[model samples]
Target: MVVKTLNGAKAVAEAVKNCQPDVVACYPITPSTHIAEEMNHYYANGDTKTFIAVESEFSAISALIGGAATGARTFTATSSQGLLLMHEALFNAAGMRLPIVMVVANRAVSAPLSIWNDEQDSMSQRDTGWIQLYCKNNQEAVDSVIQAFEIAETTLLPVMVCIDGHYLTHAVGQVNIPPQSEVQDVLPPFKPKIFLDPENPLSLGVYTNPSHYQEFREDLHNDLLQSKEKIIEIGKKFGKRFLRTYGLFEEYKLKDAEFVLVGLGSVMDNVKATVNELRNENQKVGALHLRCFRPFPSEELKKILSGKTIGVIERDLSLGAQPPLYTEIVEALQGTNTIVSSFFGGLGGRNLDRTAIKVLFQKIKSKKPLKEWIAQQKGDQK
Candidate 1:
C-alpha cells in the first residue's frame, strides 16, 4: 500500500487504474471530469488499455453498455445533468445485467442550475436497478471503487460508487492506494458467464411480451435482494486482505443510545462529529452512516434502530413527499416504536456545519416536528 495526498477524483482514478479495466468511456462533467482526465493520462502513457472520449453522458454510458456486453470490464464517471442524461441507458445497462461500474460525483439536479455537491443526482436513480455505494471520504471512495468491480462481477449488476461532488471530489486528503498485485489477488480478470459473440449468437434485452415481462422484472428484483450477501462477502474478503472492513452501514456510538442520527455520503462526517460532541456532554446521541443505499438494508436497520428516537438528515427531497432517506427509514421501522423525524439541508451545496447538525440532534431529542429543514430560515419548514 502506498499513501498519497490526492483529491477524491484523483484517488478514485488511481484505484480504477489499478483495477485495470478493459475499457473506460466517459464524458467530462464538473467534479467527475478530473477522474476521466486522470484516466486519459494513464491511457496516453500506455498504462490503461482502452479509453473512449464520448460526446455526452448518454453516449458515455452507451459505450460502456457495449463494452460490457462484449465481456469487457468497463467504467465511466458523471455528475448532475450528466447523470440525468444517462437515465435511459441506466435501465438498459441494469436490465441487461451488465457488470459495469461507474462513479457518480453526486451533485444537485437542475432547474435552478447548480454545480455543487448533493445526493439528488444519485438518489433520483435509486429505482433504476443498480447497486449504489456512498463514500464518506477519499479513502472510502478509493476502497469502494476497488471493491465495486468484484461486487458487480459477482452479482452481474451495475454498480454506482457515489461521492459527494466538490466536497470529496475536489477535497484533497491522504489516501492509501493498494498495489495492483494485491488488488489482482482479490479481484481477478472478468470471466463473464455470457457475452456477445458471433459464434454463440444469443439475444439480450429483447422485447418481452407482457406474458413474460413481469417474470423478468421479478427475477431482477429477487437477484438484487440476494446480491446483498455477495456484497457482504466481498466486503469482508477485501477487509481481510487490506485490513479495512466495510458493510451495509457504519454505526458510530449507537449502542445503548437514546437518540440516533441517520444519513449518507459526506454529510455523515459532520453528523459523526456532532454525535461525538453531544456524547461528551452526555447527550446519548449516536449516528448511522448508510454505506449501501440501493439494497436498502431495511431489515438490518430495523434491528438496530427499532425503539430509538431517530433523525434522518438528507441532502435531497422528494418534492411533494418527505425526504427520500427519511421516508425509507420510516417505512423500515413501521411496526417498531422508533420516533423518526426528517430533516433536509445541504441541498445544492449549502453548508451543513456542526452547528446545523447539533440543532438536528436537539430537535429529535425534544421530539419536535416530525419534519424540519436544517439551516433554512424559520418559516421555510412547511
Candidate 2:
C-alpha cells in the first residue's frame, strides 16, 4: 500500500491504471479533464497500451462501447454537458451489457452555462440502466474506481462511478493506493463472456421484436436490481483485501435518533459534522449517505428509517417535482409512518457549510419537512 496526496481525478486515474484496463477512451471535459490527463501521462510512460483521445463524450463512450465489445477492459471520463451528450450511448452500452467503467465528475446541467460541482448530471441518467456509485471523498473515489470495474465485469453491466466535480475532483487528499499485485489479485484481467470476434464470430446487439423486447428490458431491470448482491459481495471482498468496508448506503449515528438526514456525494461530510455537533447539544439527529443509487437500496433504507422522520438533502432536482432522491426515499418508505421531506441546496457549486446543515436539522426538529429550498443558514447577515 502506498499512501500519497492526490486530487480526485488523478487518484481515479491511478486506480484505473492499477486495475490495468485494456482500452482507455477519454475526452477532456471540465473537472473530469484531469482524469484523462493523468491517464494520458500513464500511456506516455508506457503504463497503458491503447488510449484513445476521442472527439467528444459521445465519441468517447462510443469508442468505449467498441473497445468493450471487442472484449477489452475499457474506461472513460466526463462531466455535465459531456455526460448529457453521452446519454444515448450510455443506454446502448448498458443495454448491450458491456461492462465498461466510466468516471463521471458530477456537475450541474447547463442552460445558463455554469461549470461547477453538483449531482444533476449523473442524477439525470438514473434511468439509463447503469449502476451508479457516489463517492464522498478522493480516497473513496479512487477506491470505488477499482471496485467499479470488478463489479461491472462481474454483473456484465456498465458502472458509473460518480464524484463531485470541483469539490472532489480538484481537491487533493491522502489516498492509499493499493499495490498493483494486490489490485490484480482482486480484479483479475478481464475475461469477457461475449465479444466481437471474427474467427469465432458471434452476433451481439441483435434487433429485438415486440415479443422479446419487453423481456429484454425486464431482464436488464432485474439484473441491475439483483446487482446489489454482487456489489455487497465484492465490497466485502474489497474490505478483506484492502481493509476498507463500504455499504450500499452509509449510516452515521443513526441509532436512537429521532430524525435522520439523507443525501449523496460530498455534502455528507458536512452533514456528518453537523450531526456530531447536534448530538453534543443533546439532539437526536443522524445521517444516511447513499453510496449506490441505481440499486436504490430501498429495503435497507426502510429497515433503518421505518419510524424516524427523514430529511433528504439534494444537489439536484427533477424540475418542479420533489428532488429525485427524495422521491425514491418516499417510495421506499411506502408503508412506514416515517415522514419524508426534501431540502435542495448546493446547486451550481454553491457552498453548503455546517451552519446551513445545522439549520436544516433544527428546521426538521421544529417543523415537519415540507419540500423547500435552502440557501443560507439562519441568523446570517446577507
Query: Which predicted model would earn the best lDDT?
Result: 1
The C-alpha stretches of model 1 lying farther than 4 A from their native spots are 376-382
Question: 381 in model 1: Cα distance from truth in Å?
Answer: 19
* Clashing pairs counted in every model: 0, 0
- Candidate 1 local lDDT, 141-174, one digit each (tens): 9999999999999899999999999999999889
Q: What is the C-alpha lDDT of each candidate?
A: 0.90, 0.88
Candidate 2: residue pairs that collide: none
User: What is the C-alpha lDDT profile of model 2 across 1-382, one tens digit per residue?
Assistant: 9999988888889898999889998887563558989999999999988899888889999999989999999999889999999999899999999999999998888876878888899999999999999998888888888889989998999999999998999888898989788898688778887799998988777899998999998999999999999888888888998999886988899989998889999999889999988899998899998999998898988998999988899999888777899999999999889888889977888888898888788778764757889876555533
Error of 1 at 159 (Å): 0.3
Supply candidate 2's per-residue lDDT for 289: 89
User: Clashing residue pairs, candidate 1?
Assistant: none
Model 2: residue 185 alpha-carbon error in angstroms: 2.5
Give the per-residue Cα lDDT of candidate 1 at 139.
Answer: 92
